[model samples]
Target: MAAVSLTAVPARADGPRPAVLVLPGGGYGHQADHEAEPVAEWLASLGIHAYVLRYRVAPHRHPAPLEDAKMAMLQIRSESSGPAVDPTRVGVLGFSAGGHLAATLSTAVATGNAALDVQAAVPDLTVLCYPVVSCTEDVHQGSVDNLLGASPSDDLLREVSADLHVTAATPPAFVWHTADDAAVPVHHSLAYTGSLIRAGVPAELHVFPHGRHGLGLATGDPGPDQWTSLCAAWLTRRGWTQSSPSVM
Candidate 1:
């Protein structure tokens, strides 16, 4: 399938590196500019090809963001970067609402069991920064309600909750959340990480104290600037940074 449309930061001709697919946070309303674009540009500067995904929201809910994310992955895989982007080295990075999408891609959307009329698209790994996981627990009420429609029931959330969907096949993931995130509670990442552990999936998680929610990928006040370095190192540890691209 062809991509609907995308904004890409091409790899430097000299040496392309692992690619990152970024999904911006908007509480299922709109794509945040700083979260999506600024982070992409920052990643590009670090020698990685960063793709900023402006996925659909609100009036287009549930499977819409999931479908758009899959489309983005499909587009990245379809390209032959010519010594650039080892397609398999591609990873998904999401924030807050976007983090839920990333977790969805890694667990639900990629699994081929989705009830949507969409392709099975999954990234090699997922990077979820301050993700919203369970609707029943640690719920980001606005995000969950917007994503599933106004009267979304508990069953609806049970069906879409990233934690509930994790399985042995779920892609490896790198997760982080601030203990002080009042917007989206820290339990979101904690619960999700617990599920990942129970499923025996390869995962790395970090819980930093004091950095509030929606920091994008930048440092807040002081400290935690090392988060990116920590993430980059985690990718390296998983051997995900050097994986060769493959046909979907």
Candidate 2:
């Protein structure tokens, strides 16, 4: 058996499966149990390397959480002791406010020789699990206010709209949300997906009928439980998940 520390789990012994880092949502004020560990455990069982990021909360402010996300991705990408970690197959999975962070990482980053200590951290694919898609419209009030302090500037507003920052260089993404979710609204997922489509980037969206916010993968529930199967299918289609074992 191999060790998978709670902080970060590297690519496992079987092979260099697609590494997925999970960011749980706590609305930037708190980090929840359902948002982190469960997702990692499931991904690990599927042979994907899973890292659970316990990022700095609201008092930390913008670019802080974003940098933490970048650091995590970089650490995984730079690890070379075992199976080669495929930076191209790397995916960032976030839920709720963490979803917002994932969106920021996917949209706001650019590659260059000047890549900071973060090492040009950016996932090849992003998965937003019922994410907060916008900083201005369809926004989560507490998250935005906490991220910006008071009277956020127009610049700050644009900074948070990950969709607005999308470029042809942005990674492909997949999104899911329940239509009945009033907490974050389905529009967040819709708007982001719309932007991805308009930019000619590949995106897949699933809007479940029920299941409001924070319904982490569970049994006998009407929430994100059904998402894993669909996600596996999408990964297979994108050639991210393995059909048969092979080391790179």
Candidate 3:
């Protein structure tokens, strides 16, 4: 098992703050750097503590990444007693396959597996950016293969698919995707949002008409770039953001 790393960014305030665990997308093969630090810094600037998770990826499978995410959440929550983070307010922000991992952490079965520690694994909220949400037709084949192997059983496929796992227990989610995302189709977000809504879980989804997959911050692109502000507002509404106004 490869060692996982957690990079923490403290809030500017002196008091404990809400935290967001950032998971970068890499099609389940690797972690994307752009999604890690930049995102953490953004959250930190917003007066929210941020932690970037470097979880195990491909050459690893199902439970590995999920376990890593759980560990990251626990680490952040464990700091609740200190001036680091607020345990009850910890959330997750993930991109693409990392989004899948985030959603998995949000919806996967606990199974009383001590290693999983499901009770501590649930995040207060989730924000998924162009996430790979399904294992069936709308799935990103590369992400599916990397995370579940080339010929996964139907049960395995259904089990890992985030949309299929959504229930009333699933956390509220704020999702954004590009309508033109070729790598991972937009239906992933749409389906997951629909499931969340049907389950009576609050969900907000945004579908931009342009941009490719893995756009990261989407930098200067006018339309897709609005996600940051939109997400900040959503987080604020969910109490994941700190009491202060969100930073640009």
Candidate 2's residue-wise lDDT over 131-240, tens digit each?
A: 98688886789888766677898877877788787777777888899988888988999988898899988889999988868876644665567788888777777776
Q: Rate the local accuracy (lDDT) of all candidates.
A: 0.77, 0.77, 0.85
Model 2: pairs clashing at backbone N, Cα or C within 3 Å: none
lDDT of 3 by residue, 192-214 (tens): 99999999998899999999888
Clashes of 3: 0
Model 3 lDDT at residue 72: 82
Between candidates 2 and 3, which one is better according to lDDT?
3
At residue 163, what lDDT does model 2 achieve?
78
Candidate 2 global TM-score: 0.88
In model 1, the worst 10-residue window by lDDT is 239-248
Q: Which number leads on lDDT? A: 3
Q: Mark the regions of model 3 whose C-alpha exceeds 4 Å error after superposition.
A: 80-83, 110-112, 244-248
lDDT of 1 by residue, 75-135 (tens): 7866774336666567889999999988888875433435433333667788898888888
> Lowest-scoring 10 consecutive residues by lDDT in candidate 3?
239-248
- Clash count of each predicted structure: 2, 0, 0
